[model samples]
Target: MKNIMNKTATVMAVHRERYELLAENHMFYGKLKTADFYNVNERVEFPTVGDEVEILFNETGDSLITKVLPRKSVFMRQTMGLPDQAVAANFDYVFITMSLNRDFHISKLERYLTVAWQSGGTPVIVLTKADLCEDRGRYLEQIYEAAPGVDVFCISSLTGEGIPEMEHFFAEGRTMVMLGSSGVGKSSFVNTLMGKEEMATGGIREADAQGRHTTTHRQCMFLPKEIVLPSGERIMGGGRIIDTPGMRKLIVSEVEEGLKSSFEDIEELAACCKFSDCTHKSEPGCAIRRALEDGTLSEKRWKTYQDMLREEAFSKERKKAMMKKIGKARKEIKAKRG
Candidate 1:
């Protein structure tokens, strides 16, 4: 290992085995060291987007990523058969984008809210395509119902409405990431924020209103807002924003506290149940069921909570199974070496 003091860089993007980092006022290509790949016993470690890393700069070749610093926050998901993947790390804000037109749904927003809360980032609901929606008030009401105490904005890329409100959040030294499904106008929102068409955007499918992938991978965009005065003076203050590919499937990983926080009303009601083990399904003295039957709770919201709880439980079990398999494989390798 080289003993030279290396410069610190933040990961801009991760493409397969290669990483792109921004350091020393320039962008450089980097590759992980062999030790970073094999230093862990059972867990797999690799640099991801938004990860701050120490790098040994190379004038003629790719820089060597010497160390990955600790992350303050990470956005990740657990799929059924695949290993858990980190979508973004060390972000301060997570914008859960959803177009207010055909792509709007409270259930999906609830799911995204749980993930965002679990990610250790402040969740802000960005309702894009406000120009296309006929009744913006209706959507705002629904959003407030789904995500109480969270900030929600209805923005129009064509009219530039509600775009200025997000300027403070993107100020220098802060990082934010966008998460939404395809066709939710995430790219369009990014373009409008930057005051130019930086990301290529496509139209939604006529039949299903689904969006084709315009951005193929996760990439970080350095957004520095230029505040222009009436006398032609321009002041610049903005931060980093990362745009991730549209996620079609989002599964929560170890989100028990997130679930409780997101559904605090339901949890509070459940705590008053007569039976500690109440299933909330036709059980006597079940507070959840009582609330559902009365006008206190909506059936739809209750169902969404139950569904997410089940998914979280299933994901934890799958993670346990994967760890067991990895442990067995490592033991087998040691035995073979002996």
Candidate 2:
């Protein structure tokens, strides 16, 4: 946007090639009148919020996303029914939102942490509706013991409590996405940031989609300036936030490393086991079992780790076998051509 004046000041929000572009200065969105110029992942065609792009602003108030700057980081997940899909392009932090009530589960949080680490962005635990919990003191103690070294915050959108603490995330240039299940207040959190409700939120169904049951499809929204300071942490510029569709099923596709770290306690237990391949259940010298009996580790956490590892391995094998079939088909076609 050469004539937009605030080239450096404007915030660009993108959703699949000008499907809906909100120029911080323009305040008007236009369709992709000429998107053939850009490639699939190029500007305009696959625009993601928080993406710094060069645009051609026309007099009609409609504009085109011309170029996308090199992103410092990218966040993505294995799309449902699709082997690979880049849901979000660039983001620095992943604010994994969850409530304190029936939706609370440590295993599911571990599952989200899988893709969070793989996405190249740091994951932060954001507990919504902290006001609902009766014994806040006991809950924090429990979560802290379960997941260490992870930054976790509890907030209430209604009371505007714990919101200022989220300010660390709203820094000028850094980008963060609120990922969580339906009815978990991701939208409510976004509304507080935008100072208005910009996303339509739904309630959780009788059953979740895949994993944590948060965000169906990921979308972007440029947050209205959350800060107005002469000097502070925000260097990226203003700030952009992405709100994803509630995920019913958070099955991880390719984040084995994340799974390992998420269950480091279990991994550490296997080190002193009698058998290198010990399954940790009913084994003679399984350290995991020792921890279980000693009350050092929870049975649910241990089982969940095993189940996630199994799923990751199975996903890898299934993809490999499918690739082999495709390779054989290509060979047959080449032979016929010869």
Candidate 3:
């Protein structure tokens, strides 16, 4: 009983897909028995980062994760309009990592934050490699303007400056995952946490690119000691952190509600427009357009909001199709039983 409690406290995991799990942990995996978690195509379940699971093991300490716990929060994105094809779950915070040197994109940050908000996770901006930046404050200001109510932190793994401040997110039981474009310091941050060169260090290209993709899979690490150092100093540890592969494209799901959060100012302005369905571009008495004309609304921000909504609509259609198919299958099963 004491061992169970201790093991539960140290619940960091390295995930292999359900299929891979079968080959690796056969004795414990067999407890699930008879392909229960597998789909019709023989494909098995995959564990995403940030999943806390129940496991059973033999005396050797080898174990099988028998069941997945109820997730406190999930971050999901459907792949290519396939309703069943979804990924990512149970992240408390989403660190939208971007670089100050060259790999910065306001539109990408906006899109990432909207989806992050919709995923039931707080979004935080991580500006990696501050040593490379001549003026980090200017970059942070631009991000704050693009997405209000989000905390942006800058850190340099090379010099270790600004790194300790990042430990705030690792307080106690909370979990944060970093998602970003290739070569944007996600791996560098992970290396900082491991306190060794555990992760590959990528060099930024002279062509304005930041780094190579060092993290290929989503893996969680356990920080046993609170990084809050005692040398008349503070650092944080004893929480979970998952580093995911660099994602070039993170398509939004049914995140239309998130749009308001992302573009709150636009929505607020639209409410005062003379027309209810004011297409803010050309409509008279359009507050949004007025703002655009007078520099209140940046065209780039507005355009990204519009594109996100369109993609969101497509996601809803896919969900509707999935629901309709499920309904039909249920009806047919009932008729056959009758």
lDDT tens per residue, model 3, 120-139: 78898888878889987777
- Model 1 TM-score is 0.92
* Predictions in order: lDDT: 0.83, 0.67, 0.68
User: What's each prediction's TM-score?
Assistant: 0.92, 0.73, 0.79
- Per residue, candidate 1 scores C-alpha lDDT tens digits across 1-338 of 77564788989998888898898678879998777666536455467899999888887888888787888999986656767788899999999999988877889999999999999899998998887888888888878888889998888877767766766786899899999998788877777666667788888788988778777778888875674322333445478888888888887889897898789999999998999888887779989888888868898899898899898788888889998887787888888878
Model 3 weakest 10-residue run by lDDT: 19-28
What lDDT is reached at residue 195 by model 2? Answer: 64
Worst 10 residues of 2 by lDDT: 228-237
The C-alpha stretches of model 2 lying farther than 4 A from their native spots are 1-72, 202-217, 226-237, 281-285, 324-338
Candidate 1 segments whose C-alpha is farther than 4 A from its true place: 227-237
Ranking by TM-score: 1, 3, 2
Q: What is the lDDT of residue 63 in candidate 2?
A: 62
Model 3, runs deviating above 4 Å: 1-34, 39-46, 55-66, 81-88, 204-211, 228-234, 318-338
Residue-wise C-alpha lDDT for candidate 2, range 1-338, written one tens digit per residue: 24652232122444444444545554655444355543322323244555555666654766665555666655555554444545566788988888876678777787887778777788898998887877667667767765677899988766667767667677667788877766788887776666665766555554652233344445676665643222222222257788876676776777767766667777788888999988766879888888989988888777777788788887777777766776686678778778
Candidate 3 residue pairs that clash: 183-211, 227-235, 227-236, 227-237, 228-235, 228-236, 229-235
